[model samples]
Target: MPTARESLLNAALMALAQLPWSGVRMVDVASAAGVSRQTLYNEFGSKDGLARGLARREADTYLHGVDRLLAERTGAADRLVAIAEWTVGEARAKPLLRALLTGCWSERLPVPRPARRGAVLSKAPAQRRADAGLPSPADLVAAVRDRSLAALEKGSRPSRTKEESAELAHRSEQAVRLALSYVIAPVGEGVGPLVRTAVGGAVGTTVSATVSATSPTAADRRRLQSPV
Candidate 1:
């Protein structure tokens, strides 16, 4: 069973599906959630607060899913590819999530803003968190990049130095940005190959650099050059 706040948020999403934000009424949302108008206002502070709450949940849910996917016991490149594909699929399904990730909120969607500088903060912790500024598209991309980098780092070899870690972060961002590109201007093909190319190429480059630097006196320089 959902809590009152959850119920209200769910109700608002349903309302949003059928009507534009301008068309959605507080009373209707409260009624749909089996609550009074006062309860709605109490829970969210206002309709704009509710919008922020909704956007917060959307971002939270998406990031949580990305974390879950990244937790799989897969190679870094495979994991990045998996996350990218999943992100594309999820963005296509959820309008709010698509808007949150891409920063392309349509007129029908609630393009929520943070609480004003001097506005009274909400008493509820959740509401307060929502009132805090939401992530921009760049913020979200950097977040996903960092999350991917962290996950990949955990499963990395012990021999990986700080330079390798930095390279890993760069590769992670490339994979993330490639995923974002698919979300923005998708072609017919899936995102897997492209993400793999980004991350996989980075892996080879790191290996080749590590080998060449470590084995200057090696007889087979061609083998040290590495392959994708």
Candidate 2:
């Protein structure tokens, strides 16, 4: 069963779907959640608090998805490619997520702000968390990078040297940054090939072999051989 907090957040999201944030009233959200208006207020002190809650949820959900996708048993480059592709798709589908990732909030979004300093804390733990402020686009990129690096390193061979480990982390960040760029600009088609190229080719290849010349794709050949 969904908790009252979850129910209320869902109600608010439903309301958001129907109207802009400015048009969404607390009373209506409580009514939609089948909770009292006071209960709604109790969970979230104000509309801004509710917005923080929603943004917190969006960020948590995105990171959790990244964790799950990274857990998949695949080659390292392939794993990075998978998460990059997923990030683009997810950012497109979720408004709060897109705002969180790209730091580009539309008028429809609440654009969460942290709680006022020296203010009384919310009795709700979740609300306190929301009050802490949401991560920026750069913060999220670093998070994705760290998470990707950890996952890739964990699955890698035990004999890896410090330099190789550092290289792995670098490639992971490289892939994540590329994904963020795509999220911001959104080049046509998928983001997979570019991400794969950034992280090097194939699953089993080492970082030393990255930007591989053994068998470059036609496009890779063009890019490498280009004088411009």
Candidate 3:
């Protein structure tokens, strides 16, 4: 069963499907969630808080899916290809996700104009003030890229040096950015092959160089073989 917060967030998303964000009312969301307006306010504080909560939930959903894909697939190339395909497919299915990822809102989405002074003064975390508005496109892109880098690092063979790990992470970030570019504005060509080739080539070259430079000790081999 959904908690009060989750229920309210779901109600907001359901409202968004039919109404623009600016037009969505807290009263309506509360009613839809089978909660009182006061409960909604107590849970989310303000409309901005509600929006941020919804965005964070959606981001977690997408990232969790990416994590699952990474675990199921073997090889860096295959995993990268799967992630690209999943992103494109999810973007097509969820308008909100697409808007968040590409920073391109359609007519269906409410136009998020600048907030008024009083609106900005609402009781929310000072650090979350920026999130009170729609997240910047760059911020969204960077968040996804960071997740990609982390996933790549987790799957990579243990690096002998920090520099090697950083290089691998950099390559992963680049591949994610490239994939996102296609997601934002497709070029009428398959992105899977392109991303796979680029990521696979980079990983192969990096691992080969690392291996040639220094062989893994017996302990290192055992650690690599151990289940994570």
Candidate 4:
């Protein structure tokens, strides 16, 4: 059987999913978990503490997927779209991801804003400092996509024909931007899926060499020739 602490945490996570973190209370969590408020207090110390734990538990899951995505040799544009789509899926499902997408938990709960402090505000200051060298999640995903695309091009051609360079770069930039817009902060309502789909389309166009011969597309293609 789960311990009272585990039960309370699980209840807290569920409540956070359905309602804003601020709307959740110890009494509600306790009631949902079939435990007493006192038990919750004894285990988590405060509402903020419970909220922090819940956020971390969810983030752990998110990072795992991101890590796997980065490790793959998928095309750059595909990687960007995959990251955005993954983010959208998580935001639609996980409370923590939704909180990130909605930017609600930062207001109600004590969850750390990654962009604000560089480290998840919930993490210790030392940890944040240590993580400062790493790119933001959105940026990291963009970089990975950029690298993967460049790798694909290199392996396919001894040297890119000038025409190919022009077309590919244009589409790749659009695709990366599309992915970043959805994954990053201030994600407006109804924009997530739209941006992801657009990114996917952009990737398809670029990878297929369907873009017109133009300077813009050429630049975008060259940009994809490296890790962002």
Candidate 5:
């Protein structure tokens, strides 16, 4: 079962899917989660803080799923394709994720334009370097990767070599961006086939080739795998 905090956060995110962030009050989330206003504030501090945490959690979940797909025993190419397909498919399925990506709720709320941008660009230096650079994307990714590796050890392949990590990370990032774009932009079914093909090529080259063809320079591989 989810903790009280987790339940509140999920309820808040689900409400966000239905209403613009500007209009999404803490009370709404509290009501949805069967909690009180003080409880929400106590747990999240402020509306912006709650929003930030929710967005980060969602992005982390998506990338974690990609990590799992990449760890499967399939060939690198097949694994790459699987990751792309799963990403795009999930983007199609999760209305809340799409809403969060596009700031769809903004239309209904009075939020300033900048906050919407911040939500989408969660990895910007400003957001990533919060708290005077106390913690970084490297820290978050390491924690997530460690957990993912422990899960993969159950049946999937162990961690990859430096080259493989670079390849997978490059491809995974592109796949994530493409999925976000598709979710927000809403290209029609007519364009879906073309988009898929283009994204497939893009993801394959951006990530797979980096790992499969030649080992990148030690420095470059380290940078790519660092997740910063």
Candidate 6:
């Protein structure tokens, strides 16, 4: 069973699918989750806290998928490509993910407006307390990049020296940044191919050689090469 926090977050997401974030009410979310309004406030502090918690939960879901690919996929390049593909795919499918990743809100994801004077605004004190738990967008991005780099290093061939390990880590960070740039704005090419090129260039390897060494079948290659 989902915890109260999880229930609230899921309710928020469901609300997001139906209405813009700005239009979602804490009371509505609490009711949808079958929890008291006070329980919601206790868990998330404020609307901002709930928004941040939702973003964190979604980011965790995406990163968990990336981690699974890192563990199951062979070769650094292959894993990097897979991660990029997943990121692009999720961002395309989920407006909230796209906004969180790009820091830009589209029509599908209007910015959250402040609540007008009413019962909602009356709960300002509790909301202010919870707002402290929210992480900045930059913090969220940095956390994802750091985790990705660590996964790359763990799966990489053992470095001969500390300097080599550091270099590989740096390259991994660069690979993630390059992929994110494309995620923010595409260049009329498939995400997988673009990511493959970026990762290959960063690590000084050929994409084909990386894929072949991993022994991914035709279907797997097709899946990677196809646009998200």
Q: lDDT winner among the candidates?
A: 2
Best by TM-score: 2
| Candidate 2: C-alpha lDDT | 0.84
Displacement of the residue 190 alpha carbon in candidate 1, Å: 0.5
- Predicted candidate 2 versus true structure: per-residue lDDT over 19-114, tens digit per residue: 999999999999999999999989999999999999999899999999999887477888889898998889888888988988889999898878
Query: How would you encode candidate 1's per-residue C-alpha lDDT over 167-209 as one tens digit per residue?
Result: 6777777777787788889899999887776565344444224
Displacement of residue 191 (Cα, Å) in model 6 is 1.8
Give candidate 4 regions above 4 Å deviation: 1-6, 17-20, 34-39, 70-73, 101-177, 183-228
Clash pairs, candidate 4, are 76-149, 112-121, 166-217, 166-218, 168-221, 169-220, 169-221, 170-217, 170-220, 170-221
Candidate 5: Cα lDDT at 209: 41
What is the TM-score ranking, best to worst? 2, 1, 3, 6, 5, 4
TM-score of each: 0.86, 0.87, 0.70, 0.47, 0.53, 0.69
**Model 2: residues with Cα > 4 Å off, grouped in runs:** 202-228
lDDT by residue (7-51, candidate 5, tens digit) is 787887677668777778788888888888887766655676566
lDDT value, residue 133 of candidate 3: 64
Q: Of models 1 and 6, which has the larger lDDT?
A: 1
Q: Sort the candidates on lDDT, descending order.
A: 2, 1, 3, 6, 4, 5
Which stretches of candidate 5 lie above 4 Å from their native place?
95-228
TM-score, model 1 to reference: 0.86
Per residue, candidate 4 scores C-alpha lDDT tens digits across 45-141 of 5565565556555555666676576457365455545655666666655645555444445554446433333323433342333223333445444
Give all candidates' CA lDDT scores.
0.82, 0.84, 0.69, 0.56, 0.54, 0.66
Say which prediction, candidate 2 or candidate 4, comes out ahead on lDDT. Answer: 2
Query: What local lDDT score does residue 84 receive in model 3, on the 0 to 100 scale?
Result: 79
Q: Write the per-residue lDDT of candidate 6 for residues 18-49, one digit (tens) a residue.
A: 98777999999999999999999877667866
Higher-TM-score candidate among 2 and 6?
2
Residue 15 alpha-carbon offset, candidate 2, angstroms: 1.5
Q: Between prediction 4 and prediction 5, which has the larger lDDT? A: 4
Instruction: Report the lDDT tens digits of candidate 3 across residue range 65-127.
Output: 888887797665567677877888788788878877877877766444444556544344531
